[model samples]
Target chain A: MSRLALPRWSLIAALSLLTLAAAVGSLLYGAVDLSVARLIAAASGEGDRVASVILFDLRLPRTILALAVGAMLGLAGAALQGYLRNPLAEPSVLGTSNAAALGGVAAIYFGLAELHPIMLPLLATGGALLSLALLFILSGKAESPLTLILAGIAVGTLAIAGTSLALNLSPNPFAAMEIMTWLLGSLENRSFDHVRIALPCIAIGTAMLLWNGRALDALTLGEDAAQALGTDLRRTRLRLLIGTAIGVGGAVAVSGAIGFVGLIVPHLIRPLTDRSPSAILLPSAIGGAALLTLADLGVRIIPTTNELKLGVVTAFLGVPIFLLHLMRERRIW
Target chain B: MVNIVLDHVGVTLGRRAVVHDVSAAFAPGTLTGIVGPNGAGKSTLARAMLALVPANGAVRIDGTDVTAMPRADLARRIAYVPQGQTLHWPLTVERLVGLGRLPHLAPMSRISDTDSAAIERAMERADVLELRDRIATELSGGERARVLFARALAVEAPALIADEPLASLDPGHQIDVMDMLRAEAAGGGLVVAVLHDLTLAARYCDRLLLIDDGRIVADGTPAEVLTADRLRIVYGIDAAVETGGEWPTITLFGRAP
Candidate 1:
């Protein structure tokens, strides 16, 4: 229906290629340059041992995590926007990221993160579920988007205050520093274990969101007409909230609260879509993967005293575009 | 074609009983107009009958309770157009109309030729064929109303219910919509519309249901329901009703003293 954009399938294909290219770039460009020929040789177990360790142990897991986490954020953002019928709706607006951050902070504050490798992510995911519970209780049976968003804001603010309190009451300077660094978010030195913790949950959450595409399309007509067209609003809301929690929870468990991927990617990809809520989901996911993969790549290339936090880079990149978008859409509101 | 039976249906919204124990039967081949004053529960009654709201009593379609029916099956039998909806996205008019086929679509499936045909026919019936490529959000109020009507028509259901369908239309377009509803009824489909214009309801409807304070005050032909005394009592208006012509017409003088 959108005349200026390419067809949906071709757009998806192009975005997929871009994401793949960014991923390849991510593997190739790092502090110690590893040539492609040597990288391939290392994969086959006959190249330099150092090159093999760098390729297999370091970059591959980080690249895979970038792809998975980016896709999850993008998909969740698009789905939340569709369900809420608000352009501003994203994964963070539902408070999952903040809650996950609070969980990670709690893990560091209590010295439990050192107890086991999986305890941090486990508690972080539990925190995300807790936010979901709080949101449900606050919203009650009201189906209004404003009500849900207000409840999310309430939960998110509370989580932020809790995180701040933990930071203020530091057991030691090193523990406080660890909490701050984790809160900033990163993909550096992440192993395959992190990948395993995130992937299955992201996969399940992605499926749940994609399955509601038709219901989201129906909602373009408003809640009453959507229900008349057989969209079960209550069930759709539950699925979306749970899907976002699981997907974003798994992501932030490993990568901290990577801001702007969810909020900015959908807007970037929207013009390339038919502008229907359903039409934006898959392309936004791929676009998110490309954007984050590219941003993570930029962090490696940019010369700095210390590696920039992924969330900081995303916020810097996101704010200008978001402001421009707000300016353009101000008339609509 | 279908028959809708509302048996002692009542709706309560947030501690306020909006619609009382109202019962009625609407069969195919007739257009029924529901006319009532503001806050008189006409819309709530219609919503309760369609199972769009939680209600105390049973609403059956062709002898099956609507609450027991799957939402998609209920949607297949009845298409609804709600009141004063604002489009959230800037989708094209054609795609907006195609949303009516959602009930017929399987997950991840593209719209088939049959669905496209229904969409085209619905646009033609609502006389919005030329606006198919236009952005729905940019349309004028009248055009948007017609486009939304086209979307409802695209469902091609056995029955149609429209609430305030003529709110923003011009006089000519209002007549056109009324004509379309009449044609739908004449084609052996059940049509129910909530109307505020007494003259249009009187002229186009086969039967009129007059409601006041969540109760059906009058029910019959327009002549039976649009009496001067009933209008004064129900609507709180001093008005004159003349039925000598083709259809009854009401002339308002002032509010009741």
Candidate 2:
């Protein structure tokens, strides 16, 4: 135990430092290129008004949202994987993110989001909760990866079809285009309001997921063994479901269903934590933050005319690696 | 010292009575082996005692009903090693064993010196001390079983129930585990193991429980319970019981007529 603790703590510290570097990089290395001097001056309220506005209003909120949403996805992924006892379990794999996106799109289509800003996140969270509830009901008590992923595909397809049907029937092409861009999941032109909307939900969700660390560890021994060890299985399941829904829904409301960050980040850092499901949470959160921030930064740096969508960047970076992992895991099993 | 008393305990799974009206008293300083054919509810009986499954009747630990007891308190009193193969992650042996101390830990608290000592002692007792740094998933079947046994021992609970602890073990490992359970019982813990190997049960267990169709047909010393008549009646096998050595041994002949 002593032999492993130092390395684990160091790994977390390293990942945290990397996330901080990525966040600072996200602030400094955008199209405007704010130097460290300019950033310091702006932070201290003495920089050019334009530079200050760009730094404070644009980059800071984007950086913060990236961190929070990424951390939420990573944490939710770790928790769900632990609870379900399946490494393949993630928000996107289980259709919660797409379902939440559908909910956000519905909010816009029905004009509820235009009337009140909170309705977007609220509806998105409801969608996530509903999808997760359906997934749980379909998966039942035996949480085989096959059952979970199949249920996820079913829910995801239905939610995507619903979004498309709404798009097809819309009278306004501009609203349809806006929904399409949102569904692609970009961080462009987001303000502090998006950050404010997501922070509380992410905070609550992260806390709920972290609280189940011990229970998750116990669950690695199987449900009956874990229950015998005094873990409250039902409560753990409830907390995981609601917590992942809240976090992923809030993220989807703002960023519109970023793919594969939840699935990829935990697997990336799992070996560092000695493969202990509970131990992977914090590292995965920090790693996810770094990965998403870097991915978002890549979207900015790339020479694409319209700027690559954040979700596209993540999917492009994550899918091949995920497939490789799947291949390796298949051989081992 | 703890006394686990089962009073007419019954378990219904999917509207089927898997275990019905079972009664037994397991006291400290004794190792009880639950022996029966497959699907005879031995595993379910162990689960019911730990409250992992809901039972129709009462399971009392030191005069308090287990259903009414707090889960952590129940965990502190009784440690269970389940029959299912459930190791999914590739955690090191030490970390896996440390999880046994969860019931004793406060939320967010680190494993203290006492917990570490208990974990170390458990690994030593289970004879897996050398494998502490090894990953659990990479170990052989018998080795993993020993690591799991070490995890249950690390709980240090007064009452220990293991379902099929002998499964997948080689001969030497089988003896090692049986001896460890016997030692635990001798040190004043109530150790219950569900076993299919009647010979090993007759040799090591202080008490033998014979269950057929979720009912305890016999419960007594090894010699009393491993009778040829009982073996033929319950197991549907003809067997010769030999009581010449330090322990009674059963030799199977053929199917019961």
Best prediction by DockQ: 1
Off by over 4 Å in 1: A1-3, A329-333
Q: Write the per-residue lDDT of candidate 1 for residues A1-333, one digit (tens) a residue.
A: 345667999999999999999998998888988888988888799989898888889988999999999999999999999989988888989899999999988998998999987888888988998999999999999998999999999999999999999999998888889999999989988889889998988888898888889889999989889999999999999999999998899999988889889889888888887789989999988988898888888888899999988988998988977778777679532
On TM-score, the leading prediction is: 1
Q: Over the full model, what C-alpha lDDT does candidate 1 score relative to the true structure?
A: 0.91
Residues B1-257, candidate 1, lDDT per residue (tens digit)?
A: 79999889889998999888889999999999999999999999888877889998899999999999989898899999998856889999999999999999876789999999999999998889999989999898878888998899999999999998888788987888899899999999899999999999999999999999998999999999999999989989999999998889999998987
What is the per-residue lDDT of model 2 for residues B3-46, given as tens digits with 9 covering 90 to 100?
Answer: 99999999999889999899999989999999998899999999
Q: Give the C-alpha miss distance for residue A212 in model 1, angstroms.
A: 0.9
Which residue segments of model 2 deviate by more than 4 Å? A1-6, A111-119, A132-154, A172-176, A330-333
- Lowest summed lDDT across 10 adjacent residues in model 1 chain B is found at B83-92
TM-score list, all predictions: 0.98, 0.95
Q: Candidates' DockQ values?
A: 0.87, 0.81
Q: Compute the DockQ of candidate 1.
A: 0.87
- In the range A108-215, model 2's lDDT, one tens digit per residue, is 899898998778777887888899888788878753446767878898999989999989987799889978887888777778888998898889889888899999
